[model samples]
Target: MTEPLWKPSTQRIAGARLSAFAQAMQARHSELEGSDYFALHNWSLAHPEAFWQGVWDFTGVQASSPPKAVLEHADQLPGASWFPGARLNFAENLLRYRDQRKALICLLENGRRRTYSYAELYREVAQLAAALRRMGVGPGDRVAGFMPNIAETVIAMLATTSLGALWSSCSPDFGISGVLDRFGQITAKVLFAADGYFYNGKTCDSLERVAGIVKAIDSLEHVIVVPVVNERPAIEGFAGKHYAEVLEATVTDIDFAQLPFDHPLYIMYSSGTTGVPKCIVHSAGGTLLQHLKEHQLMLDLGRQDVFFYFSTCGWMMWNWLVSGLASGATLLLYDGSPFAGQGRVLLDAIDEENITIFGTSAKFISALEKSGQRPRESHDLSSLKTILSTGSPLAHESFEYVYRDIKQDVCLSSISGGTDIISCFVAGSVTLPVYAGEIQAPGLGMAVDIWDEEGRSLRGDKGELVCTQPFPSCPLGFWNDPENKRFHEAYFARFDNVWAHGDYAEITDHGGFIIHGRSDAVLNPGGVRIGTAEIYRQVEQIEAVLDSVVIGQQWQDDLRVILFVVLREGLKLDEALQQRIRKTIRENTTARHVPEKIIQVTDIPRTISGKIVELAVRKIVHGESVKNTDALANPEALDLFRNLPELRS
Candidate 1:
């Protein structure tokens, strides 16, 4: 086994909130006398009810009615119920703090910065909640936002949830069809949108798309337009009021409606690469409890910390980032391209704002590395301590670059979870050692395990990543899935009662996890299952390669690996470069990992969230139709893969 890349010092571990929580647990429960993270995790999984109840008390979750039962039908995975008799408001807990301290700090690509104090945030939410109420938005009504990641977006969501109405949002970058696919299914009563948004130093107007969406979705009775780019966009055709006008109404206080534990709080959607996105409805209490556990205990976030995540309103990370408010930490919101000013925009924000915990995707780190931007050498990242990465698996080379080039002392947490839960199954730990290319440990109270084809548990081997127990963050159900048939087929189909998260992963010797890739995108060549990330890890190491995507092509009654490379500008894939690519893959991995064919493409298709669409590319390469090209950021990139002359050979 290799040595850990980084380990928390005695002082760091002792100062961590996780250590304090463990000590508190030891004092409360006799079985949790051990102080290590592994011991605490085991105790948590063994007694989930007591563990969750302890989290609730430790976090001081405000509730009108406490849970009569912590968990019911614990053995049933999808059927299990959590917090049986609890009545709590998700937005109220987040808005619990109303001091002079800063609650939200909004930043834009055009060097515009705004700060909202906790008290001011409360006032805005109150005003917006009043406006929404006047607009006839009641409990259980769907309220959607098609806006940028600004303070107003957060305020609107808080206001909607405060009234017990469900909230959903997508970034302005999404096209009309993508927005309609998500909001159209739920049929929201109110639509909040921005006049325009800024990206890559350019302004993109959204009124045209907003107009089309309102026309298509007949359930929208009111459209509230926020003046982001254009202060007063023409709303002559739309039946709505300006965002400022709505907040200026006569309203001073907010009345938070107490709802059941299982009441819908937010509706997250699947990637919908293959089909229409599934509207996964998450519960208020579950999202709150899970995010609190992750924020307070796992990430060790506190009132003094400043949290920043580079996310759009569409992604689930935005939802996760807002929960920092409940932790009493100041939340940072950035809207625009991270590469707007040659990648220095985000790096500058880290130093300017004294950001403590910075959250981003793996691709961003890789891009920073490829761009030859050394933040540690040029920027003052003294206040930065923890770096959280998700969206995809973090490469081992990227991990090395973090400790070597970014910061040696920081905790580089590679977290993995999806919109299905709105929280991580395996995330970082302040008390544990950080191994290269591995998540520190399974989240506390998450019974994560690796299962084989026959539903048998396995360790130290690559298999399906399965959660053997129910967690608090599980979605209530699908939006239109009346019988829960879609929900069951989505998660519980592979295993009898286990939640089969569609990821190929392995449990490491250090009690960590290494996620290979998506299980559905796993390549089976010559009857051997190979993870696409294995090839990507090697290919990305080449200096000439900017990006690459691999897929399995069916040929001669067997599958063959086909690799597509997006080379750097002014570089071409020649015979020598092909040999170098194959040599790198064969030397680092086995010969089976080498691609049978290497083709160079201009761009790779990805979703709005920056995840490469492997399955969609595979379908197009095999002369099959891609169901929804509208979900992709570069839908035209699919045309490059279709009818390729090289594939015929």
Candidate 2:
């Protein structure tokens, strides 16, 4: 029998918003009375309309007009219309709270802190929106942000969305070509950027890159630069205004535009490692409702809670984090490397800010554990109720590390979703027990399942993760993909009328989920499919291995697994270390899962959002052209894998 790492107390469960939602549903629908969480999930799928409508009501979505119908053409995956007649503003819902309570707390790498109350936040957005309106940015216009995760970035997004304009953003670290590939596709009319940003005790300037981007993208008419590392940055090369000067107008009100539920609100980009990034557009109503459900019901977040997620403007989690404001929760926005203070920056903020919900990537948690910084013994984390992990699957040892080293009582929710949906398919439930290496449940009304190649459902077996029904957060469609050709092919073509999420996953017996890796990145060695994450879990447990990336190399008449590792300083890849690595993987998984070749490298290449790019490395090893080098955080690392003598064997 497998034991759970932690379980919510009776008092905690009773106090959860999910429990209250269950009670409310039972009261409305007699058939749902006395149903457990699993039973309620099934019922939600059976009656998605009622479930979503109930969520809209429970979460108090501020809409100008109620939805006439919850769903239309429910059978079509790509074509389904949700809340067709509803009229709402995504910014209006997020900025509904107008009290004096703290709405945003901005923390920087150089030990700077800035805060804004709800009333102050509204005023800032109001002034910014007026400025954008003066610049002719209104309905259907696109505004892009090349800034860090700070209050101004959030304010810019809110101001843009308030006027029914679509907003897009990327972290300032993106190179010129990368920014051009994404923001160029959308033809953004206005750009918001920071003069520079601070990271790892260094002040990196963005003016040169922003000027380059503005010069390349012919559609940009206006540029707003926020002063970060400098009080005033020279914008002589570009036609731009200071962000502070733009907000100097005495505007005190926001004229929220009421648009259709399916109106485009955000333009997100797919990591353009293989090609030019796809510009995915998400609807306002869908994003609002989906985020609200995940926040209020799944996280049990309320006005009294302090929520924080360590993310850059480029990542989807930043979008998700900003939605916490709709729940009236205060948000902590941090801008810097997560390892600024020897990996204590984030954990220290939890104590200083009294953050109740903390979110970060799996890699950070693993690195923190390896650093031997045990927060349970060093920090006061009594206010933390939840710790969320995403970007990749959470390792089993990392799960145990959370309970053993971080906090015993907190819920460690390892969520899985991507920029495609802007929300989660499998997430944590506050009312459920915390199981090691397993996501608590498929998100409510997500209709998530694992299916084999033939589109047959599987249990306790790795397969493609699929959603058979339409959810609110599904992308409106890819920008410029007229007639929905590329959009349909991206998701629906894998399975008829199903959203193939591209993740290789399994449904555990505990009614939870275990995501192995991405289906595209799955290694096929000797005709057997192997998830890369399966190898990563075991290799990461080794003390000498700092990081690793594994891929299948096309060898003589067969495919063999190749692993590249970054070792601890002053360490070398010797026979003993290689054998020990193979032994660990072989003992935990299968002999076939062990790497055929282990090569030591200085670093592993990753995306700007901190996800390892296995496909890019594979392409480099195979002597294929990587279409966009700008998409990688460390494009130079690809040179390390090129023409390796060991792989030639």
* lDDT by residue (tens digit), candidate 2, 93-137: 999999999999999999999999999999999999999999999
Where model 2 places Cα greater than 4 Å from the true spot, the runs are none
Number of colliding residue pairs in model 1: 0
RMSD of each: 0.9, 0.8
Query: Per-residue CA lDDT of candidate 1, range 1-649, in tens?
Result: 8999999999988998888888888889998868888998999999998899899988889999988899999988887889888899999999999999999999989888899999999999999999889889988999999989999999999999999999999999888889999999998999999999999889999988998999999999999999888778888556767999888456768899998888899999888889999999999999999999999999999999999998888899999999999989999999999898877988898898999999999999999889887888999899999999999899999999999889999999999998999999999998888888899999999999999999888986899999999899999899999999999999998888889999999999999999999999999988888888888899989999999999999988999999999998999999999999999999999999999999999999998889999999999999989876768889999999999888887
State in Å the error of residue 602, model 1.
Answer: 1.1
Could you estimate the TM-score for every candidate?
0.99, 0.99
lDDT for model 2: 0.94
